[model samples]
Target chain A: MTPPPSATRPGAAALGLAGLLGLLLTVEVLPRSGVVSADYLPPTSRIVRALAVELNDRAFWRALGDTLTGWALGLAIAVVAGVVAGVLIGSVPFLRAATASTIEFLRPIPSVALIPLAVLLFGTGLGSTLLLVVYAAFWQVLVQVLYGIQDVDPVTRDTARSYNLGTWARVRHVLWPTALPYVMTGVRLAASVALILAITAELVIGSPGLGSRIAVAQTSQAVPEMYALIMIAGLLGLLINLAARTVERRALFWHQSVRGEAVL
Target chain B: MLDVRGLRKIYGGHGREVEALRDLTFTLDPGELVCLVGPSGCGKTTLLKCVAGLLAPTSGEVLLDGSPVTGPRPGMAVVFQEYSRSLFPWMRVRDNVELPLRQKKSLGRQRRHALVEDALEAVGLTASAGAYPWQLSGGMQQRVAIARALAYEPEVLLMDEPFAAVDAQTRAGLEDLVRKLWQERGMTILFVTHDIDEAVYLGQRVLTLSASPTVVQDELKITLPHERDQLESRADARFAELRTHVYAQIRAAGTRPAPTA
Candidate 1:
């Protein structure tokens, strides 16, 4: 049954904002009151001022754009590659078994560990960042897609087969719908991982992004500016996560989990 | 006509193999409505899957109109027991019903729409056609599954305990709906159930199956009037006799020890 619109309140949002303001006030007070070294940990007000200055800089915008470009491109490639590979491998028993060991072996190797190889192969450019981002993000999507495909009910498969649906038809009509929710979950996870790896690659490889900019500020002892850039990176992560969640909720409205949220 | 000749299905390999079906043999004449009744674990599902061409028999074959059924044929449709799983949750009721017709490619867009509407009307779900399967009641969802099968216009329909998940009242309603569909379409149907009364009420003939390593234990002609009512027909003396007869066979089959290799 659908509940009245007025019955649902924005209690969570109000509480979250209150908590964030309290945390920011504490951070601002700690260094200003000499509870911590202001040289290393500047007051929140100074960081905010540094953020305002950086926001107006043309170089800051270009670096932000480059980071996002790497994230988006790497995420796009991983999703397409993962879904195709996952569907193929998941549907075939022999292929699933053969690849299981290889997947498990490769999945655990940290993407950061491949930084040396990536730098050697692609130098300090978008390619280096993409290499790490794609490698990390690819696993998130591949595993989720595989799980999603496997989660398809056997009865549905049989029902499709009984109706004389061809391989392509079955995948389009049955398999895709059943696996979509899982794919969305995979994409959400991959989105976050892609951002993390993109920043890490830029930081380690001296690429032209916010991560490299933050590294430069730190080396020059621009503490407040470094904190501002770090805060921006954190904010970007939050924005990406929120956007992924919104997409998932909209796409999987028919799913029980999403429907349950609406009812609650 | 559909012929199942000595069908046997074994699961797993070598020492751990499970014999699901053993030497199962039967035939359905065109327009015949046959119900297979058995004890739990009697391999009714395995047999139905083999006949639907969804699974291969370890030995023997299923022949549909004199041709061996190697895979799913265009002339056959199946309504699986789990309606929730059988019907695509992502699609609307009408879309689910239209899917098989679209896949057939014989029906154009207009014909497909007419068939979907007709099937939904037959299942008394015309008003709910636009709703998703999850939005409907369990009985309604099951009806959508049936509607999907009906829209296919298959010569042979295989139903594996299709009404088992519904309540008694809903199950009775569906059983009547099925009988009405059968009489109207004159399509051959192979209905499987562990419920004795269901087999006796809905089928022209009832086939009883043995437990584990299942084989057809007995086949009995229902002999009930074609224009049977749920209240009157179920209360009939013949209905009581057939139900008792099938129940005794199932109980006997259940009590017997499974055969050793």
Candidate 2:
């Protein structure tokens, strides 16, 4: 059997640190050896030095805050609205049938395509960013919730009914339990979309965010700074995904994925 | 006590009326364990659903304690064959068992906990009360479903092919558990099954339904002793005789001509 998580996590962390150092060394060698252009991939050491300089700048911190706040607000709104709407639609076949064609029509339209319309309606600021983020996140989460609810077995519903479960009780006890894994899947998926849309809204429509900061660095010919900002955005996406996964694991420890893991 | 009179069910799709049950009539006394046996498509399931108030009869009435069953009453609980689908996958076993207790007006939290514990213990699931339904084997999950039903302390418990999905060994064990529970709780149980041997072994009386557009073809009273063991019950002369009698009735019902106006 494998070691306990307490021991495994520290070892995993060390491995990840080693991998980062190896990547830094390789990138450092590439530019000096003329193996790759420094302009495109600015050596990792230079990027880290630039990242240190940007960390002390008040404006960089402010922009990061603005982007993160917008992402958080947008994701929260999408989750509440999407899950509620999904449950309502999933539970009622008639409602799902009536609105399905409309959802399908709109889902394929990318959030990037909505930048101009959002800017027109909400102006070039947090409002536009929030709008795009919510739009990007909603459809994915909604579909997952619908599938989760739909996947709930008819026998469970019948069992709930036999127990004299009221409408609300059935949703709380039966429907929610059966649909949780699907909802978690949707949430994890939506987190990435939220990050992408937040960045895109900033980059395309001139909102104050890491994306806009990168644009500024690019215009100034600060290649290292630009690369560092891009790395920050990547890290942000990783953090969001990690956090969502952790929450999913804790909440659904009884779920199949967790149970399938060999116990210590 | 429950009564069924002139019960009819017709499947309306595919441009042809498929009558599942035709004027089925029967009466079940309180504290009786009755097994219903019939061929496939003989409306054994339809009758149980009607009696449980899950499905409305096309015509006629299912009376519960002299009143018509319009919807699920608090006095009834059901155990279905699909154990995996019958229990919520996310909830712990204890929560699943306690769910039905939530609907009972008289059960406070303390009382409910005691009842749930008792039911889980009775079903040999106390050690697994914290586990999820999916974590257990098929037989274990079925036991949890039974625990949920028994916890509710309903006056009438309906089981629809409750053990058909399990292996023969598990089926026999569950059959004995059902008999013990029925006697201990004094709850009226209407068990529907396609297995004649199972019907004979578990029930105090067996009700045989005719093929398609099912009606009660025969009702055989089990004169065997109450305390049952799987090995001895099958080998006993009385058990063999009762099984033979029920088998013959079901076979005859299977070949009988469809009723014509």
Computed on C-alphas against the true complex, the DockQ of each candidate is: 0.54, 0.48
Q: Could you say which candidate leads in DockQ? A: 1
Model 1 misplacement above 4 A: A1-14, A261-264, B12-14, B256-261
Question: Alpha-carbon error at A159 in model 1, in Å?
Answer: 1.1
Q: Residue B153 lDDT in model 2?
A: 84
For residues A1-264, what per-residue lDDT tens digits would candidate 2 score against the true structure? 333475578888898889989988998999978899998887888999999999999999999998999899999999999999999999999999999999999999999998889989988889999999999899989999998998767777777777789888888887887788989988999888999999988888889988898888988999999999998999999999989988988787776676564232
List model 1 lDDT by residue over A18-121, tens digit each: 99999889889999899999999999999999999999999999999999999999999999999999999999999999999999999999999999999899
**Clash pairs, model 2 backbone:** none
Candidate 1: residue A160 lDDT (0-100): 82
Q: lDDT of model 1 at residue B33?
A: 98
Q: Write the per-residue lDDT of candidate 2 for residues B61-130, one digit (tens) a residue.
A: 9999999999999989999989988887778899988877887768799999999999999999999999
Residue B224 of model 1 has an lDDT of 90
TM per candidate comes to 0.92, 0.90
